[model samples]
Target: MRKLLTLKHWKNTFAFIYKLLMSKEVAVRDKLLFLIPVIVYWVVPDVLPLIPIDDIAFTMIIAEWFAARMGRKYNIS
Candidate 1:
């Protein structure tokens, strides 16, 4: 949890995400698994208006989850 507050951790997370998205080795379908929901959430925040989290916060959380899952699945560092 403490790591999440650091700028370096976020920079690395975003870098990993950018790398994953740009890699041809990862299937489009696999990439869509991360993209679709994030796009939807950003485009349609009212879908879950009860949630207090901000849009960027949601994206970061999903980004972290996606990075972890896809990294393991694709054996990416």
Candidate 2:
């Protein structure tokens, strides 16, 4: 546990989070990656209605797709 607190470990952690955040796969198919949100939304309708949930989800999918395409097109070496 102590080893995990080192600068190296923190750097690795940061890098992993950065990659996950930037990843379109995660952004779009994150449901596949993490189903916690889905379960929560289903279990608690008052928190997020089905219609609003669908709207937010579909919007994220489209946005992630567009971002992924643009990233690929403008990828730099």
Candidate 2 lDDT at 25 equals 55
**Residue range 1-77, candidate 1, lDDT tens digits:** 99999999999999999999999989999899999989998877677687777889999999999999999999998
- Determine which window of 10 residues in candidate 2 has minimal summed lDDT: 30-39
Off by over 4 Å in 2: 28-77
Highest-TM-score candidate: 1
Q: How accurate is candidate 2 locally (lDDT)?
A: 0.49
The C-alpha TM-scores of every prediction are 0.89, 0.35
For candidate 2, what is the TM-score? 0.35
**Per-residue CA lDDT of candidate 2, range 1-77, in tens?**
67544768555544544465466655445423334554455567666565555644543444345445444644511
